[model samples]
Target chain A: MEELIQQLKEQIIEVLNLEDVTPADIDNDAPLFGEGLGLDSIDALELIVMMEKEYGIKLKNPAEGKEIFKSINVMAQYVNEHRTK
Target chain B: MTHLGKIVITPRGVELNSQVYPTSQIGDALLTACYRSCHADYPKFFKMDPLCRLGFIASELLLQSQDEERFIPREDRAVVLASCNGCLHTDRHYASTIHAGDNYFPSPAVFVYTLPNIVTGEIAIRNKYLGESSMYIVEDGLTEEELVQRLAELTFQDPVTTSAIIGWVDYHDGDHYNAILYLIQK
Candidate 1:
């Protein structure tokens, strides 16, 4: 679980092109959108695409992402449960 | 048709307001070097595709020394830009990612920049210019005459537009790029 979270942190930074942010800076339980990382709608779409491409996890409904991508911890847990690859 | 400011960024160096900037460390990568030289803390610049970055830097240079609020408000200024390639560089990059069926990983980050107007959007987002922003794809190349004609058409199109940032920003391949942006007061 810890390794998945760390990997998720690295992937988030790389995929989003967060040049100034380090993996250590992202708290696992902090929200990924709004106040925490301040990522917008575009970032959310990118995260959705990343989940499918990286983990072979297809999120059929976009609304489900609101809870699934609430935070790094939630995302890691969801990916761990549903990831095909 | 009064010119407020002009910035020309070429493979050689950058020329801002008719004065050639120091091109010491700006060897071949002129746009990247110029962006670095500006010392602006816009991290979103790094995420933009090369064409958007070119337009972004050019617009920044044109607006750097001006009192932007005096002549144009957020909704009064329009960005009318032209480009030859029109996101071809990013299109090719995105294609490479998806073409290899077995190894296909289509990146949304790269895919989002597949439109030419995204450059205008980037500038608008950066400067908070909520006015009309448009990009034209000039396949052959954009001549000065065509640019002027386009600018005239854009200015007269809307009564609300009083000022505009007009330019030809083209990026081909990775390193081949050129931009000539002008701030014009209508």
Candidate 2:
């Protein structure tokens, strides 16, 4: 779970391009959006696609994943339950 | 009098950039290169209409400051973009995507970028600039002075057009693009 979270952090940093941020700076349980990481709606969509391509989780509606993706802990829990692969 | 300002040129795609993305495509490369050069994040841009991406980048460079609000005024600012292709690359991409499969005809993604003035719209939104805006199409390159003269004449009707964004955005199928922006001040 820890490794997965770290990998996810790297992916997030790369995909969303938080240029000034690094993996170590991200807290595993910290929120990824607003206040926590300052991500926005567009970042959310990118994350949705990233989740589908990398984790085999297809989010029918990006909005539904908002709560699940609030933090790495929540995202991992949701992914563990729903990943197709 | 010649409008005074700085000219910033950006070239997209290495091959095309050699001639600097000349209006003609002389080399072969993936279409993605065109989108990639202007943005570090491809998927984010791929999801957006190409015009939006072009506008965002161009505006970022044209405005080029955090305190742009002072330069871009509600009444004085105007936007003018000149392009030969005028979204032709995006149109071609969309046609191929739809032609390949009938089930999906309209690619909202590509379709939205298929406008000549989208760059202008994007500039307006990013800067919150509510001013006279227009797009011009030219068959061949015109000197910067000529472009400024043309734009000034067009915006002459507006009294407060002291500063403006004028540029040329042209892209081709071989993933080549050339965008030049100049901020004109009277």
Candidate 3:
């Protein structure tokens, strides 16, 4: 779980093009959007792709991501539980 | 016509020779490069608000070092942005994730950057420009006559339209972008 979270952090930085952020800088339980990471709607979409590519979870309705992506804790939990691979 | 001066920012570098910049990476490369060539230090004028792409470059050219006090509230400052794709680059990139996989839900982060006028908003925030602002996405390139007429109307009718930045920001691909800003005065 710890390794996966770390990988997710790295991926987020790369895909979102976060200029000054690094993987170690991201807190595992910190909010991924708004005040925590200062990410907007676009970063969320890129994260969606990261989920599919890294963990093999598919989300049919993009809207469903609201709750799932509330925080890295929620995303890691969801990925752990529903990952097909 | 409120012909001010033409400030062209292309991806390849400074376009002092009136050369057409290749239309690629219209989002970051073209916009940032244009702004960089016009200004010595790119960081001085760069704002990472995501919406600060085209208008940011054009406005940087017009304001130059006046950005510190640019928001002093001029009576005649208007923001006029015309782009073919608007913020579609961010939109399409976001959509690709949702469409690519079934469980991949759409992200709110990616969704907000889709608006065509976000660039205009960013410009307003950076410059504290409380004057008139607008965006137009035409099927083809905007007709010169139409653009000229609009400029005329803004300068004549609107009291807060002293200078304007009118141009096209079309990002059809990752490596293509084009912007031409005209800083007009009454």
- After superposing the true interface residues, what Cα RMSD does each candidate give? 1.5, 7.5, 5.3
Look at candidate 1 and tell me the lDDT of residue B144: 72
Residue by residue across B1-186, what tens digits does model 1's lDDT show? 788888888776789999998666442366667777887678787788888888988888788886555334479888888888899989999999899888877877898899999999988877877789988887655577678567667664888887888878888865577888888878
lDDT tens readout by residue for model 3, B23-128: 4444456665565465434342332433445557666665664546676765467777676767777777677757856546565555656777877766766677
Q: What is the lDDT of residue B42 in candidate 1?
A: 85
How do the residues A1-85 of candidate 2 rate in per-residue lDDT, one tens digit apiece? 7777778889888767665578888887788887667777767776887787677787787678779888988887888788786
Query: Residue-wise lDDT of candidate 2 within B43-84, one digit each (tens)?
Result: 344344444555555455445443546444476777887877
* Range of the 10 consecutive residues with the lowest summed lDDT in candidate 2 chain B: B22-31
Query: Could you give the candidate ranking by lDDT, starting with the highest?
Result: 1, 3, 2
Candidate 1: the clashing residue pairs are none
- Lowest-lDDT window of 10 residues in candidate 3 chain B? B42-51
lDDT of 3 by residue, A1-85 (tens): 8876777777777667665578878877777877766776756666776777677877778797888888767787898899887
Cα-based lDDT at residue B156, candidate 1: 49
Sorted by TM-score (best first), the order is: 1, 3, 2
| Every model's TM-score | 0.87, 0.64, 0.65
Regions more than 4 Å wrong, model 3: A27-36, A40-85, B1-5, B16-52, B72-76, B84-110, B139-149, B174-176
List candidate 1 stretches off by more than 4 Å. B22-33, B36-39, B67-73, B139-146
